[model samples]
Target chain A: MQRSRLGDLTAFNQLVERYQGPVYNLALRMLSYEAAAEDVTQEVFLSAYRALGQYREGSFKAWLLTITANACRDLLRKRKRRQETSLEEMVETSGDRSVSPSPTPEEYTLRREVQREIQQALNHLSHDHRLAVLLVNLQGLDYGEAARAMGVSLGTLKSRLSRGRAQLREHLLTARGTREP
Target chain B: MFRRRSEPIRHQRVRELLSSYLDAQASERERELVERHVATCEACRRYQEELRDTVQAVRGLPQVTPPRTFTLAQAPRQRMAWALPSWGTPLATATAAALFAVLILGEVTGLIGSPVAHPTAMPSSEALSLKALVQPEAAPEPTPAASDALESLAVQDETPPAATQELSRSSADTSPPPPEEAAQPPLQVPLLPWLQGALGLLAVASGAWWLRRRRAIR
Candidate 1:
């Protein structure tokens, strides 16, 4: 990112080509709506472009994801302003419409159940906690990487992730067998 | 939360280090220390299991590739931006050129009469006298009178008064005049353009920045 900001278009392109897929996937996981996720992905990259001059020599992906998390938060805030929500709000949209790879019947059931539980639990979390949880848990970021991606200190990241995971665990446990697989 | 240990050791730092420990990122010495402590600490061991489980649950989420037809691959390539204000940006480069031209013209026609471009520069007494006569402007006062005058000027506009009406108005103007000292606003000569050409360039550059910001918002 630093190289790109220093008048290296090739370096910027290299970053895009390298991280586009994973970033899109992260957005997809966090947002659940393909179109919204795609929009967030674009917003993430656009934000990175504007902030490229501030890039330090470190993990580029972490910075990119932090911006992506911010974009998702903005979208969520916009959604809140509409006084609307997912299907429960009767907003006329279905959830989990973007699961990848054709799943077998059994796999589909488990995936759907997991998806619904996770998404609902995610909605229940505070924005920062959800972001930390998503990056660390769903995106396979270690605490350090998650901290970098969240623009938080490692301790803060761990606290949020642990609290988030505990909440998700509680939510999942409360929903035990309530969702048919 | 305070539980005394038979073998006293640091605890909060160790708990915080659990984040790094779970990720296998702790230094060898730190890792060894944490592992040894965990051996005697049931609470810490359970805490580590919980973190491990949470990590697993998150990792288990389906990596849903967006429905292929709904890819953001169509997302417009974000073009690199400049910090130039659109209207003011051109004024910068043009400013340099224009100022350069003005400076050159002033130098070229200093005392000599250039027939075509500067036939008017030959009046020595005129140039020196105008230079002498131009006085610096003082700052304007912020008074109710000026505001009221501006307001009155705005309000009583464009109606032709009848003769009897004018007579009535003139008759109503019998009040004594307020002090003249309060009426005039001081002249304010802006020193911005002459401050620094480089600063003007910088301002143009800032305008370019503002312009890009506006563009980005759009």
Candidate 2:
């Protein structure tokens, strides 16, 4: 952290390498577009590099996740403005994924199906609720860390997380019902 | 009747607590209430299990690898390029306007591009020849000899040539020449306006650039 703050590029790149997966996944889950997620991920790292000076003592991963969340939100806002698409509309349009021809084995297919179902459920969530759930469950952040990342109080984070979980539970159950014999 | 009515409200409260309890984020009292309710209520137990499954499914989602490396190709600049404050455009505009006003004032006050003052004119064609010779166009580059000749002309303008001739003849080398204002190079005057104009244009360009950047951000 010290070396990066002193303008050491290599040190900052190391931080990028370490946190890129979590950052990229967070962006991917939040934005739900592969290209935009990649863009937001790149934006997040560059933003973190420039803002290294302002980072005080805390979880660096949480801080980077905060940047990632903010970048995703900004892009989502722009996307909303340009397309004027609401979240519910996006979920309805994008939730159903047609199964691709699986060159991979059965386990991979099953996993992909499960992943798709969860991503659809996440997509169905409101922006704030989705972020709260992702930060805590997907990213494995503690309540405090998730709260910091979401810029909400612990109470608010829990509230959103609870609502988000309830919605996800309903969606997943419906998905399961359709899939079952 | 009270038990049936209160059961639904208790069920609702317990469902809320189950989410936090699953994450181990519930308070001790809330956890105990949820556990006590779920131990007997089949519906609440199923809700807790389903909520837990939802959280686990989300957590189980595979971490997608980034399509490509996100490391910046080059070291970032010292600061965010767009970190300019809202007043940046106005400040640049004000600076440009102030410099423009200064340049205009300079031209209006005759401070810039003013010809050097000729203190006195001799009553002869010698002064006319000197004036013609010293025209900036004719003598674009002033030489030392031209200034010295002008100085001598000024001395002659104040004291008649005949009297200087008599004085020189009487006191061979005793009398000193009178003091005169030094001639200023005309090159300096025209350069001032160009410099100020360049500065004003630079300021205007930067102001425009800042305005465009701010709009793009919005």
Candidate 3:
């Protein structure tokens, strides 16, 4: 981290390597659009590099996730203001998965289906609630870290997470029921 | 009857706790309460199971590979830091100052536009006659030769206004010019003022732009 702060590209690259997956995944789940998520992930790292001076002693992952969360919020707000988010446009553009193929075709197909449902469920949430769940459960951040990333109190974070989880569970089950029938 | 009424409240509280409980984030007391409640309450247990499954499903999703590595090719930020280089504002300020100086110098030297009105240039005697003649706002009827002489006196040297006034008197005494001759148009207005005004505006605009850019960069 010191080296990266000193403007070491290799050190920063290592940080990017270690954290890109979580950042990209968070963005993807938050946005439910592959291209937009990629764009946000790139933007997050650029800002992280610029803002490294502002980072005090804390969890670097949480700091990076905070940047990711904020960027996602800004993009979502902009998208909303422009009235540019259409369900059909999102579905059409978001289905192109560049993730490396899984070991088995059947497993990959099933996982992709499930992941799509999860992404759709996440999209159905408010930005705060989706971020809360993504940080705590999906990104594996603890309650305190997730709270810090979301800039909310632990109680508020937990409330958002609980609400988010309940909503997500409902959506997934509904989708499953419809799919099966 | 009280147990039945409190049952639904307890169920709601336990359901709220179920999400945190699955993450092992509940307090020890709350954890114990939720565990005991879920153990006996079929509805709370089912809700916990569903929430747990949802969290697990989210966690289990495969990591999406980043489409490309994000290590900036070059320090675009460093480039941005240098975007308005250290010398930029200084250069802009210097340029604006220079332009301002040029404008002031041009005005003082009468190079930019017609010289400021020279009220005291005419001699006292000539001034009385000139003022009397101009009082009626009638154009002077100096002959063509007199007009030519006035132009020459005005242009040939940086003569004080008194000398030109004397010249006009001598010419007026020699031959009062025809009204037709005196009906010539007044001196042409110089375009230099417009040019100088534009330059001044450019200087101000450049300074403003530099200040704005500097603030944004900071």
Best by TM-score: 3
Give the TM-scores of the predictions, in the order they appear. 0.53, 0.62, 0.62
Put down candidate 3 lDDT per residue, B45-149, tens digits, no spaces.
Answer: 888888889999878766667777777776645523544545767888999999999888766776556533334432466555654443234444555765675
For each candidate in the order shown, give its overall lDDT on alpha carbons: 0.60, 0.74, 0.76
Model 2 sits at a Cα RMSD from the real structure of 16.5
lDDT of 1 at A97: 51
Model 3 chain B is weakest, by summed lDDT over 10 consecutive residues, at B114-123
For candidate 3, report its TM-score. 0.62
A110-154: candidate 3 lDDT, tens digit per residue: 767887788778778888898898887778889999887777799
How much of the real interface does each model capture, measured as fnat?
0.29, 0.58, 0.49
Rate residue A46 of model 1 by lDDT: 61
- Residue-by-residue lDDT tens digits, candidate 2, B24-80: 889999989988888999988989888888888887776666667887779877555
DockQ of each: 0.22, 0.31, 0.32
Pairs in clash, predicted candidate 3: B143-B177
Model 2 chain B poorest 10 in a row by lDDT? B173-182
Candidate 1 chain B — worst ten consecutive residues by lDDT sum? B130-139
